[model samples]
Target: MWWFTQGSCFLPFFLVVWSSTSFILSYLIALFRRDVDVLFPYISDAAANPPESCIFGLMTFVSACAGMATIYSRFKFVEKLSEETRVVNPQLNKTTLVLGILSCIGMCVVATFQETAVTAVHDVGALLFFVSGVLYILLQTVISYQAFPHESSITVCRVRLAVTVIASLAFFPTVICAFFVKQTDLHRVKDSKDYPFHVASAVCEWVVAFSFVCFFLTYIDDFKRFTLRVMTELG
Candidate 1:
């Protein structure tokens, strides 16, 4: 259809909107239910209980799937560009795809395992999701630089670099503060001695997560000019 032919941009756009909506909606629900403090709560804390848990799980799972599709499409786009430009490293392109896929898988794991119900598993999932996601974007930024003045503009590269750096800088504090946070009660985190650490970690987490959404937003223009097609053959 003509719409599909011109709608490649929709993938990244949907991802940005959908993932942001999932987080925001879950946070609002948690706040309304008093499941979490009005102060900054860890992303997981915001969706740790039902029925918010159920909503968060389903929404995040769909977002993860959309993320996977968007990443795969990106991989294909870069591969095609490489074939045309001969400037892109084939190995790097493949590696980026692997990292992106792993990140999406991590997102799925995070969605499936609720932190309060399965703390260890959820933490592992969050680790995988955040670490891999950050690395994926960093690699993608490098790729964008490599494609510079050819398939990409200097301004676009700078924007991607900025986002990557912000996410990377926030990541360390998010992890460190989260580790030192001794508040076991999510609702009473603000009342705990470790409240500052909890708030710091949560704020950093949100920063990193939104950084991801902003990074994907940069893909919209590139995606706009590229369209995917499926071919079937019986041999």
Candidate 2:
């Protein structure tokens, strides 16, 4: 949707090219290596193609939309913290602000590409999306750590640490999608039946979806509690 990503017809884009190459290489690495055989067997889809999409589409849309919501909430949190706090570590605010916007941009870009650009940017944007989610979770954790109460960045640290682990766990399937690509029948935008890829995609989305749900339900309280305790200490 943004100019940065649109109308740049086959610009020999460095990132996309790098990603495609990485896919091939990773696949080869898995193929030749014995360990990867075991690994791939676990991750690989036994089914010929992904399952039907009526339900899958809804689930994908919901997870993606909820991810957008969580990122938006993060933006509001950062804005509030920045105005309330002084310049102790302004870089934290800057990173959170920029990455939060990027998270939204990344999501919108994929949605748009998926809708149009049938042959061009669809999966490419999706790959970028995988990376974007990674960046989103990382930056959010950084913001949490930096804006944590000065008295005990420790508790916040633990929380962020947990967040990071969950985020990382949440990230593996995107990598799997990247690896399988069109080769994996389930992930293909066109009619494909790779059931395992679909299952993997579902699993990952479930993790991310639940992660954000827990984040909103639990971490909103954490943020509010942290803010109040900080203010009380300062007062």
What is every candidate's alpha-carbon RMSD to the true fold? 1.8, 15.1
lDDT of 1 at 49: 90
Any runs in candidate 1 off by more than 4 Å, and if so which?
1-7
Model 2 RMSD, rounded to 1 decimal: 15.1
lDDT of 1 at 5: 35
TM-score of predicted structure 2? 0.49
For model 2, state the Cα shift of residue 216 in Å.
3.6
Off by over 4 Å in 2: 1-88, 115-120, 150-157, 181-202, 222-235
**Residue by residue across 1-235, what tens digits does model 2's lDDT show?**
5332332211213222332333334334444443233223322221111221222233334445554444544455566666777523566656655664555455445444432225256456554555655565676666666666732266655765676678678678755754554452222343455546654765675455334334433343333322211234554
Model 1, range 1-235, lDDT digits (tens) per residue?
Answer: 5432365988998899999999999999999999998878888888899988899999999999999999999999889988999878989999998999888888888888998788898889899999999999999999999887776789989999999999999999899988888767777535577888888888999999999999999998888788898999999
Give, for candidate 1, the lowest lDDT window spanning 10 residues: 1-10
